[model samples]
Target: MESTEPQRYRFTGHERVFHNVSAIEALPEVMALFGYQRAFVVCSRSIRRKTTWIDRLHARLGDLIVGITDEVGEHSPLSNVLIAAKQARDARADVIVSVGGGSVMDMCKAMQLCISENAYDRESLLKLQFVVSGDGTEMLTTSQAPAAIRQIAIPTTLATSEWTPVSTPIDDETRLKARFVVPDGSPEAILYDPALLQQTPVRLLWATGIRGLDHAINTACSSSPHPFASLLAEKAVALYIRHLPNLGDTTATDSFTQCQLATWYTGMGQMSVPHGFSHWMVHIIGPYGDIAHSDAACVLMLAQAKWLEGWVTPQHDRLLAAIGQSDTPFHAILHDLLAGLGMPTTLDDLGLTRAQVEAMIKPALEHPLVTRNNVRPIKTAADLRAVLDLAWRA
Candidate 1:
């Protein structure tokens, strides 16, 4: 008998802009929506070091700004979440405004939850924190449940965290792949500003550009399909295909808009199918491999895409064409593009030795989430081993 399980989902997003806007004017309005008088701005060390945007935001927001928490780091590690939460608590910040990429946004997301609940560890936190009423009820009440944090995201990078309900957090002990926090854990608003992106490192600019592409392509090929999201994903693919090559040559705003649009659309798709093997593998190898999330994500995209070729549908075919390739051998074409973008084309480049690959299989095979969604299911340790072999040899 064929197995039966639910194959569809409803997606919701944060109430905010995912487009280019003037930060000087937008920040205050977002703060007002969350009813926050004092905001604890969270950002990456890199953004803090390089940009005057944060200072300008503080100056612009004036009294609404409580203080700044500039200690956010890469990967939204659990420890850093604790630290930021503590700092936000100490400052008595009424709301959080994150002003960087995925890492910063994710950090604020977690901080909101921790502060609202007065808890630090994820293990101690309540699961299924919010539920949509059958009659369409929203908002979790203090009487009915524990409260979560209110967060606002000002994304400077195109990694699409603003669009996703899932947040990747690093494990302290293993230092490997972390847990995924749910959408209810996300910020209340996401403010997109292209001016903030201008200050990003050239390398990060390219990496996040590819990162946004991965979001689009991965969603296009996800197990669950939606006509609207597929169209948006194709559009995102077209944007990256055109803009990525012109990095050294263009001052294009449209491409970034395309990326932002794609990120927003695909981020919703992710709520349904989310990421597949690539995301799982990245999670498996992240902390353990010392690979950056974007780098790890891009590294596995083509390899996973190659695996996804056999599962191609008309929708997938159209998406492939948007990236300037025919459906036939789509994986090969995608890999070629990834190689040109300076992304790691193989697992070896990610510091995974033969022994480590062998060690990673058990955990990967055990992960029900990623393994189950694969176009070709991964059922055994050997199946994961083969995927690892392909990734290692890439």
Candidate 2:
């Protein structure tokens, strides 16, 4: 069931969309086409080692590969972002190409702002004027003074970070969570190729698929659910259910295409309402335990959704139906899906102890976005502790 969540906030930007069959064929042309003479390609070490697509891209683009950094991890820490920005500056790159999952994309987006001098200092990143009252309007805003650093995104994992304007990063000095600098820095081009994702480890694909699902579920059941966002979320859930199960056996080009599109849809949906408790908790868990973002996300989804059941309304049921599942207790169906996919439906599976659950109370409650969006207010540490107790044990 949905809550009587008031609709507030307006979304911005045009969807600059593109899809290609091969990264080799598309990378050079897209770069050249977008007038990006040279770009800094940022990826994760895991991604670089597993896939030869970047090598092929480098071969195709040649000198256009102005700089390369593969240090992206679960979160784009400020140190990494600064290192990347320095590398881009050294290379004199005018464009940024990110070629992994959400983390890589987040890093790239942040680097774009940093390299452009819009947010030269980390402290200044948190002080930008938010365009809260605009309706799909574009304005030329400056931050330390805007310099051109175009973005070209090529996401390999299904975590949909490409569709958002913000990036999550950890502060270099303080180690506190910080959002990467972004205002009017949407990607100039996006290239989605399914084969590159085929190189992704099966476990990561499975895990990120769950993260994609969380995006949809959170958006559908969000306090301010929009019809457009709900449609994207519903489609994402249905596609995720079908493709993720047979991800190993299925090599059909269409399967990967569907997964890519679903992730994009989920990304767009999430950019509106953002994520809720599951995401907040997962974000904390991944960095604290040094776990994969997707792994942390999948493990927490069912438990968090189960917790949400207590607060659900009829609108939640309608959303479940819209996502191609009949509205019986959604927690049961979601748990079954998790079990079948070999994802942990419980927190204990991740090696969290009762003590760790107790520890999660403060961090989870402290996440401003998730804490604020909760339909049921988290009034005190006691309230969050009670929820985490159930989530921890489940």
User: lDDT per prediction?
Assistant: 0.68, 0.71
User: Model 1 compared with the native: what TM-score?
Assistant: 0.87
Q: If scored against the real structure, what TM-score would every candidate get?
A: 0.87, 0.88
Runs with alpha carbons beyond 4 Å of true place in candidate 1: 1-9, 121-148, 180-183
RMSD of each: 4.4, 3.8
Tens-digit lDDT string for candidate 2 (1-394): 7657654433534236676467668777777776778778998787777667678778888888888889876578877887888788889888888888888888887777776664556666655523322422122233554546767788778877777666667666654466443654566667888888778877778888888888888887766667778778888888887787777654666778888888878866676664567766776777666566777787667766766776866646775676567656777777777788787766677777777667656766665544555555554787666556555544
How would you encode candidate 1's per-residue C-alpha lDDT over 15-97 as one tens digit per residue? 66646788768878767766778788787777777767777777788888777877766678778888888888888887777
